[model samples]
Target: MRGPVRWVLWDVKDTLLKVRRSVGEQYCSEASRLGLELPPSQVEAAFKQAYRRQSKLYPNYGTAQGLGGHRWWVAVVKDTFSQCGVKDGATLEKLSYNLYHNFKNAENWEVFPDSERTLRSCTDMGLKLGVVSNFDNRLEGILRACGLLSHFSFLVTSEGAKVAKPDAAIFHQALQRCGDPASSVAHVGDHYVNDYLTARSLGLLGLLLDREGSTLHLDDVPARHRLSSLDELPALLQKRAEGG
Candidate 1:
């Protein structure tokens, strides 16, 4: 028989907190501050293109290219600003520095309404919590700003693990940190491939937080492993605790 789950691992981004201002919106704001004028629509379009290109080429947030956290982001920032019509090298560097640093602001993100109560419920149930994310260490700061950092006992990042999700190394690293049997842990996140399938394949219970029913039609996702909101988590796990 499987042991009681002792740990609940989480993913950030669309799971706990979401960005209030998108990258394009922030880029336009920064450009205006630096006296680089461009139409908002143009800036937004450019950012989308740049983001898609960089993401496809480097995937895994540029870690696949052997770029460190900041270096990886620097490429994206450069590509974004360049596409937005700022041609001066000096201006690009300045914009990159300010834009990257400004994103760390707590005001730029909003936590899901059910996040706190759900976390507390897990804590009350005696389940240890930690984060397993593809993000860099800046995640700690963001979580702290959102008041969710304290809820986690530990956090493992792609930068720290030397690999990103869907790859198994990062999850294994988190498992080692929790020091529990894989069957006695659950991982929850928004991504179907990165969060659910990856963890489940490793013998960990994986649930997809499908806030929008985006993947509800996929035949591969079991209904029991899907959630529309975090508020559903404690009760679902309670059933598991009861051997349901």
Candidate 2:
């Protein structure tokens, strides 16, 4: 473990927590209450579409922080409703933001089944842990609420780092906090280019958790491991450590 990976850095959304339901669920429900009459499924679909639109916004806006981070999600909800034939923009936006505020107070975030067990095992193995995420400042509190704050000794967020994935500085900041080497620390994520390849570029181990193959940039990098499931992680890491 002498590489940039003496510590383990995790991504939040899509890595540990699955966000099975929309993060905007409560707000979307409220939108329906305001005569939007939008089906839950339609709202969910619109949310996903709007979420992906942030990729375009970031480059043009030079926004290093995640575009869909709270404020962006507010606009996303507004735009989504507008596109889906909702007439009252101002009221819906307010409702959306109000719902998002409730999320800020929420502690029980849904997580993948293997998430807690995996992090616990990593801690038990004596590895230092941290998070490098394209997240809002609320990430720490959210993880803390989910009973996960104790696992990570540190976290570097886009809000704190002022840059998102593919930026080596963010990862470096995480390593600096953990007092570890990037070469020894394996970065695990579901994203191909943003997380795994970025780790590879920094001489750290890159582990890809490609459940749905949503990693469009997958072919662009030579990842150290391609994991189709989180269940395979512990064994694979043990093998890598033992030179298997």
Candidate 3:
């Protein structure tokens, strides 16, 4: 039989918190401050394109290529604005730099309504919490700024661990830190592959947080393993503890 969950690993982005404004809106707002006029829709489309290209070119913040997180993001921001027809190099540099630092602060992010209550419930249940995110080193500061850092026992980032999700190494790093068996831990995140399947493959209970029912058509995701919000978590754990 599986052991009762003693530890819970969380995914930060989209799961616990998200940007206060859409990337396009934020980018356009920043660009406007630098005297560039661009529609939010156009910037958003360009951002999607630039982000895809950057991810393809420099996967996982380009750590292997030595670009590192900051430079990788700077390149993405530059490409995003460049695609939107901003030709001034100084403007691109200033915009990218501003955006990079802007996201590091709490004003740029908002915690999901269900996040803190669920976290507190988990803590009350005696479960140890830790973060396993594909984010960079700025995560601790961001979490701290949001007043959520104290809830976690430890924070592991792709930049710090040198590994990202969908790869088991980062999860292993978190497991090592918690010193718990995979069967005794549960990982929750919004991605079907990165959060659920990957963790399940490593023998940890994987809970997919499908807030929008995006994965409802997937036969691989059953009702028992999927959550529409973090609010469902504590009850699910209670059920699992009761061998349901």
Candidate 4:
């Protein structure tokens, strides 16, 4: 059946792939190898603190092309380790590089159970697909390694767009590449602000894939726009087409 959505834009990471290891767990492992004995929980806490600080310091950081991406992550890693009591400059540098490099491998991630089937079904229904992500250039390598790069015709990363979601620039860039009207596009992502509301504000259908059903109390999002998984997507699109 025909659908109102002509294009489906995806958000990578938790939306499509579940990162098998937490960043803190991975960082703690790396630190242990370097003789640092930080608690995993402490490392996780530090990582979050550092991440928030870094994000503020460098809004739309890693999405930039070239060395800016590398530098941005290096700063984050440095701050993360700093929080864990690793105060040496050279050690922080080595750890940051290794962590960044390690994430390029697909083994560290797992595709969501409904991801492939949903992508295939959408493609079969003639809807074009793309990705709009706040991630950096490493996303392409990670997606290709995970066997998902081919499913998307294009991806606009924060590095590539010079901006991240919750900002209209990235969405506009994706729309330009897909060459579709905003009304014909729907973006599926886990973040209520970055993924759902931002796309909706831009005139695209923004569906929240609330796999954890964590935000039921939020009154701003309609029940119809909330999805537990991509499995319900095609049926929902059909309903939208029928003006439900």
Better TM-score candidate (2, 3): 3
lDDT (C-alpha, whole model) for all candidates = 0.87, 0.72, 0.93, 0.88
lDDT of 4 by residue, 132-229 (tens): 99898889999989999999999899887888888998999999998878989999999989999899999999999999989898999989899998
Which tens-of-lDDT digit does each residue in 163-215 have in candidate 3?
89899999999999999899999999999899999999999999999999999
lDDT string, candidate 1, 103-173, tens digits = 78788898999999999999999999999998876888888878999999999998878788889989999
TM-score, ranked from best to worst: 3, 1, 4, 2
Candidate 2 lDDT over residue span 1-244, tens digit each = 3422357788888789845456446546666666555667677777767657754675312355445366666766676666667767577767667656656543336778888999988877767888999886778877877778899888888876877787888888887786656677888887777888798888778788877766546476444477776777777777767777
The better-scoring model by TM-score among 2 and 4 is 4
Give the number of the best model, judged by lDDT.
3
Model 2 off-target regions past 4 Å? 1-5, 22-27, 33-36, 41-55, 58-70, 105-109, 212-224
Superposed Cα deviation of residue 210, candidate 3 (Å) = 1.3
**Poorly placed runs, candidate 3 (over 4 Å):** none
Q: Quick one: RMSD of model 4?
A: 2.5
Cα deviation in Å at residue 134, candidate 1? 1.0
Worst lDDT 10-window in candidate 3: 28-37
* Candidate 4 TM-score, C-alpha based: 0.91
Clashes of each: 0, 13, 0, 3
